[model samples]
Target: MSIAAGGFTVMEAEDDYVEYVPVAKRRALEAQKILQRKGKSSSLEEDPEKAKLAEAKPSLLVKATQLKRDQPEISPTEQMVQQEKEMIEHLSDRKTLMSVRELAKGITYSEPLLTGWKPPLPIRRMSRKQCDLIRKQWHIIVDGEDILPPIKNFKDMRFPDPILKMLKAKGIVQPTPIQVQGLPVVLAGRDMIGIAFTGSGKTLVFVLPMIMVALQEEMMMPIAHGEGPFGLIVCPSRELARQTYEVIEQFLVPMREAGYPELRALLCIGGVDMRSQVEVVRKGVHIVVATPGRLKDMLAKKKMNLDNCRYLTLDEADRLVDLGFEDDIREVFDHFKAQRQTLLFSATMPTKIQNFARSALVKPITVNVGRAGAANLDVIQEVEYVKQEAKIVYLLECLQKTPPPVLIFCENKADVDDIHEYLLLKGVEAVAIHGGKDQEEREYAISSFKAGKKDVLVATDVASKGLDFPDIQHVINYDMPAEIENYVHRIGRTGRCGKTGIATTFINKNQSETTLLDLKHLLQEAKQRIPPVLAELNDPMEDIEAIASASGVKGCAYCGGLGHRIRDCPKLEHQKSMQIASSRRDYFGSGGYRGEI
Candidate 1:
């Protein structure tokens, strides 16, 4: 007997009993038959009524219609106009949202995607209102063809997300005016000269750009330790360099990760072990913050090269020049490639600085935070005409009334030591530093002062510039500097970061006579109150305008005298003779004064 399957037959066993197939095999055979039927079903003719019924069946989706159609039978033209109005309103909302997002991200909108829609204008479209705003709000001066990009906040500057996160963590939410205006100029690959008060966030102006440039370069071509650093920041002092290095490291935290190649910044300053610096530098560095002396030494010793340096910045540039590093600065500049970007920052723009800038920078954008040589208005300054012998007593009295974190500046190392010893003897914790001290000693003194382990710091002019101690309540000029510029820097040590501070200067006729006229002018310019003696000593001839007005003659502006043009002024001739005599005196003094009595 045989059991018939679909197009096949299964014969029974020889015992005449039925032999069942496995369950799986039976199901497989059934599936094959179903697939055959399905394949052949299309070819076989179907009923037209069934096809019509299948086609008539609809999905669960409902047809769309106007919701208010039941209310009224409106004209087609009116409906078209209403729909157009609604579409326009929707488009306007979308455009507004897009504009806000772009503005926040410091991005300009692209051309419109739709046929009828127009692209929004730039939010920073430099209008007359914005120009007036900048002029009125800041003492910004632009010399190049490019207009500065205005920033209302850090968000408007469009810093990287990592940087922004770091800034937020550091509690820095807004960009200072200088940072806002100057960072854009630096990032634009142009040389810039930034003049702002000491605590106006000038460090970050170049720091942000340096980090951004490094990150961008790293992404494109991985930075290697062998090729040298991509950024070089030159500061006037070792402490300033170290401070800048710390700030860079703080900003670099988010860029370096656990498993990634580290982004390194090295401080190649003196006082530290050179071998350790050389070792780390051999490994690689993305940035280098260094002093002129140490950096020049490294360059001479062939430890570093500037061929790969794309960005160079000078902090406290005027001080650097005043420190007599002009030749060294020029030598370092020679090492850099011509295509490198140079940025200079100073508290004041003097003739020497202007000349150096003209030679060193290429079409630099000048960013002045306040007046070019203006002092911090936040500082309350007073002058005391103490006799030279009475300064210590006066200083002791001032210290009795003032708070800690006070900085005392002297003229020489001996004065620094004397003041420090005097303060120590008087039961005041004090530390002193000067150029004469060893590097380790200077470092210890500064560290002690910064850690609040010492209440007072006595130092020469070496400590006057670029050392940022945040909570200094007072700056005491134990001995006034001969140049008024140095005086400006000295007093600036106290009033920083918008904090109210007091600066007291000890002035006397014998010691401060050379600077008395200039000091009076500076104090007046800063709007500080003068003592009776200082006010009495004010030179009438110093004010060219006042003297000229009083003289009632349109005399030479240079000399402020009658019957002399600027070119033919007797004072000019006298000044020329004095300069010649001074140069001769210097020459003879250096030559041991051959014919001196």
Candidate 2:
């Protein structure tokens, strides 16, 4: 049988339709028939005690009124006690109890400030002319109030005696431009965003401040088990995290030998046994250097936390954002239980990164050693127009241009392997690293190259972002990267510590015209000798300056690519389409509209 209801048809068996009755009505009809046939009392009627009890029960409104009258008024103190009891019960979990105990201990403990520690004196005390001259001499551009004077030497900063000795031991007698100005801002407890050339001692700018913060916290109140990470340094890659961890460890050794409070630093990164990291965290860590993925995992799994983390540093900030770690970074921020001194250090400050900084950092002072994205003046840049087929053959000649400890960056892992094997066949001491390699292999390659045991290290852009090889004499770009920002970082691997180095790049027809244009501009800006091929390609946007003036923006504001204006940016368009596709997919998947109209 078929029947129609609303706009759809319904089919049922013939007997089902005839015999079906509403359940409520059927129950009532059966009760009536039972009364008629056997004259039996209903269950509720037969239970006299239950019926009487039901009659005695008051209505909800009456009961609520009675409850209000029966309860005694609680004093504010008694209410607070109740609240405390409830909170303690809620936080009875082991992890939360540990956090509470550490917080209580931190609040109760007190100690004198370390000897020789003093607040940084303001630069305003100096004559205006002297201050101007000092900034000009160091090429330091600072944007913030009451900026501290640049330190002439390590002593001017008033570092502890052990730190001074350690500095001298490492042959670092004077502060670099960024360090001179940056150290004071961070030590003063102000947030900062530091921009400088890749090899301009940017690491020390944050690393030293991190050590100082961790040391102060430890002295004031040592962290208990499962209760720290007083200072946190988040890097974008495992190699950078390892390097930063090592720098912190090196600084800690001197303080330990000087009989200071014992402080522990932990390296949390992927491709290592998580059990080991958990074990270290359970013991307690004063400082943590980590990449985003493993750090997020540890935080999510309740193995570690940032309840006491008072200092946060994002090294290679631009690279982190570019590599799509921004969400992970924000998620990590959610784990922080209090305000922290945030420091963002990077070689390039693109518009996207600048926006991210404004949103993430609080009233940060920006210190720029040179114009953002500018090439290092200390490096001699050479560009060659070589055919794609002949590029591999010319690699041998390029290797001879520099001494041992040279870095070669390729765009692809397969190319890195090819070049590495080719160099080995020709009896060159070379090592290669890329994402394809395991952690142990990558670490060995980097360590061997840094130790000068390997004459050349070939790798992808993974090595280019923020890996510091202080003795590297040359950097060769096996292929120009897709973005101009990457090209800047690639060449910056050399020419560190005020020492001059060389950068060589090979270009061919396979490269894009936009990239060639950006390279031309960069070479022109750096005053390097431009190859004939790059010199001939004219920028099609002749009215770029006028357009920028009208729009109140300069360059490609989207991706910060210098090759094209915003309207012509391929990356911008690609990102826009991707966003649209993602939104559409989300909409359809969310069941917004799936059926035909």
Candidate 3:
């Protein structure tokens, strides 16, 4: 017995007038006839047995359509229910349809019906207790009219199941304060400015929402090439951009398993091939993690545009402005013709940054996890007064006294190289990085240091901004930063994520007069014990401001006397001008007027 054409079973006898042929042979014969449209005879015509078998076969197309295939048995009622679901999904809007398809593909979620694919919940009013809870418990203060629902945990939040699962897999059992508060505002489609400490899990606060919003918008309408990315993340350094790119890539793994196509996340940074980057943009991208310099270059070459971009984020925004990226950042914003949601995250918010936020963000809710520019409460700070000639001796003592996994920060490349060389001569496992080194050398130094191959890493301000090295036991400020905000960021490398660490700084008389007053106050605020030497120096900035205020008339700055300006006073004119010119000459000598005060 054999199953033949149309799934019919037949019992054949040895002498019966029946010819048997395989289904594969019948299809091949039909394909031969179609290919030889010229009516040329094939092997079947030349062979009597094959011809007889071919003649017994039915039309190949009819046989293929009529074949009964093996399928799971489904009851009539169950089949009717599945058909109804298919009909509803087809009639729904694009986002709803996509949601249904995603559910069928194993992406689980508990949110209610999607209203035309809109976010699960709209902006809602909160009670007084809710507001106070966010402020008092989480230390997140909001300053805007946009109300937001409180997200107590990931399970209750409106995030897609794939993102939530990725979070769990990443070992994030609880939401950081920044995430607990910032996620709700951003997911509600409101602009936000987040101020938090280093290693505070601020990256995921915006990244999760950025991906979700971009994907949702893409489902509704596809993005066009050269119209810019759906989401743009700008940082100050190439290293920081690369870190963000890796994080986003990690989160996208679960989404890929849920039958969603892998998104194209591009790293648009410098020190790479520009032509290759341009070619990538020519195809398309969902998200772009970029540094200001390379992104500006791409825009100038017309390789990319941001007219249709829907979401924009600036990580370490204060550092970006300080590094003279203010103009480039503004230029990038000029191309946004459509409405965009902007988010700014920084460890500190200076007055200039506040002004920038006021202009760039539209009624943004300000979220602060701690006081701006305040050192981490978990870090123990210490300062030693060392002369210029004896600084290296003191640094050697500190290194010998401290444990492994130490980071040393220098003011310039010259000091970085000198310190690294001295450490190598002393048989210390160390590596160095600065702006002067090529990209490959910098990357290798960082990698070796991260892998524990090098115990100490010496670098300039390039490493001060956004590099994350886990378990950094101590930070040595070889030279104190010129600005107070920078000191906060430099020492942030240690004492991260509530882990206690130590930071030591070398202070000379030159820094004592300018930085001591501010440093003293900062140390007191962070509850660190202040050194008697630093507590004795008076704040020069305060004295200067007091002198300016006491002189009520147009007078000489040096003598604070009326009726004579500093430039015209015979007693101090030449001396004052010479002093001003001397300071500028030494400070800006290498770069000339380009480094003006």
Candidate whose TM-score is highest: 2
At residue 213, give the lDDT of candidate 1.
Answer: 74
Q: Name the lDDT of candidate 3.
A: 0.72
Residue-level lDDT tens digits of model 2 in 238-305? 99899888988888898899998888999999889999999999998988999988988899999999
Which candidate model has the greater TM-score, 2 or 3?
2
Q: How many pairs collide in each candidate, listed in order?
A: 1, 0, 0
Off-target runs (Cα >4 Å) in candidate 3 are 1-126, 223-227, 539-597
- Candidate 2: stretches off by over 4 Å: 1-124, 548-554, 573-597
* Lowest lDDT 10-residue stretch of candidate 1: 111-120
| Tens-digit lDDT string for candidate 1 (166-242) | 88997788777787678667766777888887677889899988887777667678866656788999988887887
Itemize residue pairs with steric clashes in candidate 1: 225-284
Sequence-dependent TM-score of model 1? 0.71
Model 1 residue 577 distance off true place after TM-score fit, in angstroms = 14
Ordered by TM-score, highest first, the candidates read 2, 1, 3
